[model samples]
Target chain A: MDIKPIFKTLIRNPVGLVLIATQVALTLAIIVNSLFIINQRLDNISVKSGIDEDNTLMISFSSLSDSYNMENAIANDLAFLKSLPGVNSAMATNSLPLSNSGWSSGVSSQSDYKGVEIGSAFYFADETLVDTLGVDLIAGRSFRSEEISYYYLSDELEPPVCIVSADLALTLFPDLNNPEEVVGKKIWYGGVENPKFAEVIGVINDIKAPWRGWSEPIFNRVIYVPHKPIFGKFSRYVVRAENGQLDNLVKNIQTELSNFDDQRVIRPPRPFSDIREVFVRNDKGMATTLTIVIVLLLLINALGIIGLVSFWVTQRTKQIGTRRALGATKFDILTYFLTENLIITCIGVIIGSILAMALNNWLVTAFSLSKLPMSYLLGSALLLILMGMIAVCAPAMRAMNVQPAVATRSV
Target chain B: MLKMNGLSKVYRTHLVETHALREFSITVDEGEFVAVTGPSGSGKTTFLNIAGLLEEHTEGSYQLDGIELTGLSDRKRSALRNEKLGFIFQGFNLIPDLNLFDNVDVPLRYRGFSAKERKQRIETSLEQVGLASRMKHFPSELSGGQQQRVAIARALAGEPKLLLADEPTGNLDSNMARGVMELLESINANGTTIIMVTHDPELAARTRRNVHVIDGQVTDLRTVFNNDNVERTAETA
Candidate 1:
């Protein structure tokens, strides 16, 4: 309760106070920011990709003869995949979700595709796209069998109709609150020289772009066009097996497909779980490394406090005895030391808030990071204060046990 | 008033037991100034520690201001020390980091006094000890005599019924020791009982009575002095 006097004495002899406080400040700054990044990676790793990841697998192959019919080959492959036992649906498409390969493009609501533009991942598939990828059609209707368009990448024609992801629907038509209202909005694409427009025939609930390790604003901004993209020398299909049958199908799909179409070289089939694993591998590693760093920093900070407070208790033994003899109870002595540390920790946290913000500002410039929230600072400050109290407990108890008779001795 | 009857203190270890006080008996009336004189390890400090509640005696009954302190908890003893007793030590024991005002405020803070009352008592006690002008000065900045005065102010600020001094002038020069003795006599004249332990016979002679101890037992030195009555001091020891 003698905070003013105790604080005055502490500030006059500030070496120990400054040392421990600097460690607290540094630890808080680093840990809070590191925790933010770790939470970010963790959040990304767990975000819903809006697909049935457990039941989907991808098979890709390259044909030996470039003179083959692309549509016939894709139709034949799809028929074989869907006829297999336990297979729910199948589609020959451009790329799979959460895979490293992607198709990104810019689209706009204005003619010539030049007004308030945003980038999006484009998926080219047939009428079975919804059934094959297992994405929910929250509003409007899927592509009809007669509306399906077959083309090669060499042709510069864009699909006239597409089903937009929920995020893309909201961005392209910001005024519309309901997804059903956005079902009829048209967006321009393909560039100013060859301006092409597509009507939004439907809206999927959600989906992520196949890319990772970049800014997050573009992940769910995607659109799936009803186009069966055909390349003469290359082909791929996404097949959905019934639950619990994906691993078995993945094991046998490549061999079966290669045997059925011997003119093409079939690559291995990968289940969606494997694609997701490869996507977040580096992010998980970064999160784990930062987590270890935060824990070690906290330990070092706690140890620094323990060492400093123990030394203070040792050096001030006679002072403690004097206070005890002056009618201070053991509990009073303990309170004195704890209150003193609380004051120092309070000062450190104040400085740490500023330091954490400063560190976050630098991170924003270097890595284009987001602003650090105030909750992180408050939470981390509470953590540091708790750790400080725990670290100083043993030394404070030692201080409390100093013999009152020490005052009568000739020190 | 203070009383101790058949008080005994034992220090025990795994190998040996040392009896610091053997059936010690002492009685001091209200407003009396008593001096306890003895050599080293002669139980002078053991008596002082027991009287101040700094250490507990193994066996005995101790009463201060008519309250029995035997078998009390540490919290109650601390409360009694803060409420009914004051102490001034040989080394002054002034916390060197604190200024004169804060040093004097130590005991009052333990007594749970309000900030206004604590400050008032601190200033008044410093004025009584002739250090009112140096309230902001640290103990290190003051002379030995001034530091002892600050210690006296600290003890006086509590306004206790009994004051205990353990070699209050052992570390001071002759002139400072005489000045401190005058202050103690002045404080005693204000109707507070005092028991000071000292090695200097000259200082012991200045008190109204003396109780000498040797080897854990009371020894009547029977010093010739201008005592109005020797029989009363004799009966107390």
Candidate 2:
């Protein structure tokens, strides 16, 4: 059980020990970093978008003819969609959550204030927008039916009323304890010098906008203006279905839209969940690739330990026999080998902990990744130690089975 | 302290069964030094292996210090070996990586001796072999005689009731062989039973008793040599 002897033995075979230790260290570093990144990506993809992802479908279209009347076309499509049998609510908006594109603007508490502005994604929709998106209205009331207006791009007019997300409201009125207190507050949008102010009619629960990055702190900040029948060459429709009717709605949406305006080209209609999947597809791919790399790294490290231990067993056959003849039992021999490997693995783990932190620091600086937690480093060390033991088992058993009579044989 | 009755060892194969030892029997009293002499391939090593508890006999009733060895589990057997027996090999099988102190410490470690006790025993055993000052030196740093001494120290550190030596001086020069033999004599004088296998006639003659074996059977050297001398005297008359 004296590790001093084991250390001396390892010192004698520096090359093999160093090689195995280096392999273990590298494996720990790579696996820890990969797992951290994978965990981060998983967390990013799991962020709640505050939409009824399963029940809502987003359908987009662009006007193919220059003479297409955007306002009338959108109104007809909305009415037809609303009349569908399973459709619970339908509203046209500039963008859909998890569709990967939206509009952003800077907002301020005071129209004349010239300071850092809070940035938020913009959503322009009608009174039915809350119902279609399934967003919870935590305070105040949604826009009135009469407050909705069909605004054109050439009209050069902004909606007088807007709903702000709870997060955005908190940014505007940080000292306010209640969201109801933020209801009558006014926020100025556009540039401070030429600001346009709108009353905060309602405070909705958190919702993520499509264009925001998962790492951004303001991902949930959004403002909704009461604009109906969005006037543009392209328009997005958010349609909500009754329970269990999402698939049916997605299937029949293109036909429904085309029946309203045959001159327009309709893109495919997809469930919000599918759009979210497409949006974070790269993140999922990254997680999968990192998982594979971690698995391969562990396997290679195990093989390296096995190979080095096997070679040591072969090289020390006579020594093992001598120990056996000198009253060392099979278990003693086995423990000696296992303990030796543990020492080597411990060395690697120490070096690997440092390397893992360094790599995480680099990631944090280079890609804005969160710092690696100490718990993960400790977990990785324990894992590698276990791997070292498992990898050394066979070779140690071989050493144990060496006959004491082997010492009596010459050479 | 050691006894074997009707011991038989058979080496089996698909084509042939080699009888390494047939109906072999031997006994050594407590505190006695006995030497076993045999030619190459004469089953001496087989007997030594079985006697050391390193290999199982095909059929035998063997007892060491009044404990039945047959049919014992490997754990029991190993425990018994660690508690009661020690071994020295001709090749001076000292682990090259370990220093002389640790080489002596190996058997004591297996015997479950406390670290302090192990250190004391290792130091005393090395000192007995006149290598106490060289305890820090590795086996590779020592001469042939010194390495063999370290092996002897390793065997002695357990304070075993029985010490088995297999050609303990085979790989040494005559001077070194003599030195190892003197060390063995001193150890035997300390009342520990000793069984040595040797091909050297001089070494065999030095022991308290010598047993010669050939063709898997023990031969009575006294009867055979006396009979030959009588025949030569009659031919001369």
Best by DockQ: 1
User: Compared with the real two-chain complex, what DockQ does model 1 have?
Assistant: 0.70
Cα displacement (Å) at residue A128, model 2: 0.7
Question: What is model 2's DockQ versus the real complex?
Answer: 0.66
Candidate 1 scores a chain A TM-score of 0.93
Per-candidate TM vs. native? 0.93, 0.94
Q: Write the per-residue lDDT of candidate 2 for residues A1-411, one digit (tens) a residue.
A: 778878987897688778888888888888888988899889878878888887988888899877888878778888889999899999888777667887778888988766448888888878887788899899988988799987666775476889988988987788898889999888988686678889988988978777665545567888899886455688778899999998888888898778766898999987888888987898899999999988888888889889888988899898887777767788889999999999999999988888899999999999888899998899889999998899999999999999877877776
True interface contacts retained by model 1: 0.66
Instruction: Give one digit per residue, the lDDT tens place, for model 1 in A1-411.
Output: 769878998887999788888888888899889989998999878866788998998888888776777778788988988888879999878887778786888888887665677788988878887898889999988998888877687887578899888888888778889989988888788877777888999999878777753744678888888877776578778899998899889889888887887888899998888888988898899999999998898899888888888998988887888898888999999999999999888888888888999999999899997899999999999999999899889999999999888888775
For model 2, the stretches where C-alpha displacement exceeds 4 angstroms are: A154-157, A214-216, A229-231, B220-237
What is each model's TM-score for chain A?
A: 0.93, 0.95
DockQ of each: 0.70, 0.66
Candidate 1 lDDT, B70-174, residue by residue in tens: 999998888888898889999999988789998999889999999999999999999999999999999999989889999999999999899999999999999
lDDT for each of the candidates? 0.87, 0.84
- lDDT at B184 for candidate 1? 97
**Which residue pairs collide, candidate 2?**
none
Winning candidate number (lDDT): 1
